[model samples]
Target: MVEIRGGAATSLDDMVFEFLEYGEESSPESSFSSGDGCYDDDRDEERSFDVEESKAFWDEQMKLLQGTFYRTNSVESKIRQATKEVLKDAAYSSQCGCGRLRVEAGGGCRSCLRREVCNRLMNLGYDCAICKSKWRSSSSIPSGEHTYLEVVHRSNEKRGELRVVIELNFRAEFEMARASEEYNRLIGNLPEIFVGKTERLRGLIKILCSAAKRCMKEKNMHLGPWRKHKYMQAKWLGTCERSAPAPLPVGNAARPAKSKASMLTFDLSEAIPIPGLRRTAVEVGVI
Candidate 1:
């Protein structure tokens, strides 16, 4: 029996029972709440890490691109300057030997432009030629062909010949219709016209391809086989055909034979004369 003391004395067993009941009721809820808090913290931490990693990746890419653009040698600069001059003159030229208008400010015929550039470079005493690279489809990539200009220079036998590639639409080559902002920004830094050595071009290709892979991974998109590094390298670095352009004809010999009635000034009446039909104005009544 329990003895009553002071006010009302409770049994020791009741005190222990009450404490146990309280613990049992609160333990699961408290533990569950703690677990949820820890999970949230971990998730937030992971997201922050991902964001930081993405930023670092783009920063590194930008640095590489800027470095590539800034590094240039005297040979590259001389050729680049000459190429620019040729492009300017071609853009303002009346027409090509084929009687077709030259390229305008924004756009024009790239084939003609290439021929003109090759000719101009050749006339300037550079060993220039139009190169075409074609590859058969393989297990990893599809068959494709590319045409561009190259200037080969051999300073000495020991140094071998250095190939300088000239690409007119260099920036467009890497553009994607569906790409992230970071990826597009990276491409925007590329020059519209690229004039560089094979080594420099190879480095640029590696940098761009790596950036493209990262972008696709971040967006959870599949990269196309054609856009792969191997494919891009194959365009310029693979087996190719080099063709020297014919020099532009001199004086009137360059123009082709023109017929009496050219397409631009052809008259149907003159070509087909109807026996009883005359050039007379006849009024037609509307029905």
Candidate 2:
């Protein structure tokens, strides 16, 4: 009888003599080898299934993301149009009190941009305000605060207060320094300036957060906690403070010019005569 180490030896295999087996009949070793082939086949099938399942998941995410972006309601459209107009006008004529450009990029005045958009929306008869959302650090996410413009619409009984968020640099918020191509493609579809209802924004956050997770998985990278869904949702949806948009105080139209006499403009020869001082007129001689 053969002795097996680290495993139980089968009695049937022990009793079956190799000399008794025919050429066509399988031996114990061959049978065990065949079982290994079946196991490999099953593993291959499982791997294929996982790959297809992952592809389907990303595909569905892309579809849902595009759908959410394309769909818009009246309130959102109105606010979007108004926001565009305000930004356009500001680009041509507005400069922040801080002397920064009114663009959304770095070195640009984000507060000025928000104030301008909010005030303009209010002028359009919308209840727009600058909202500051602050949250303490939790187990999942760190403490952080976000400031953005929001419009509150009091619809009829069926629809209560509708909150539409306006993010001037919406795309930048989700941009990752190192991300998969698929994730970049998803973010590419996002608007630089986002104007959408809270519900719509919530849907977008879910889609993007899922995409981010998938992206990290594909890249075999770790996703930062701040990029998670809860953090993103808290930026706009969480409870916070809201203040009505007020026009930035206009700087003085013109500062009065200080009066000063230039020394260069004063004529020394025209000085008033001092007492006991004789005026000397010298005649020029040409040699």
Candidate 1 similarity to native, TM-score: 0.73
In the range 1-287, model 2's lDDT, one tens digit per residue, is 11111101222122112111222211000111224454586667666776677667777888887667656666666666676667666656445745554443321577876787677778889888788888889999999999887888898778788888888777789999899877888787676667778887899899998888877876668889999999998898887688875657553334456877789877555666567766688897999
Model 2 residue 257 CA deviation in Å: 6.7
Q: What are the RMSD figures for all models against the true structure?
A: 27.4, 23.1
Error of 1 at 14 (Å): 89
For each candidate in the order shown, give its overall lDDT on alpha carbons.
0.73, 0.69
Q: Give TM per candidate.
A: 0.73, 0.71
lDDT of 1 by residue, 72-164 (tens): 666776777787777767666666655665544422667777888899888899988888888899999999999888988888569787888
Q: Clashing pairs in model 1?
A: none
Candidate whose lDDT is highest: 1
- Please give the lDDT score at residue 211 for candidate 2: 86
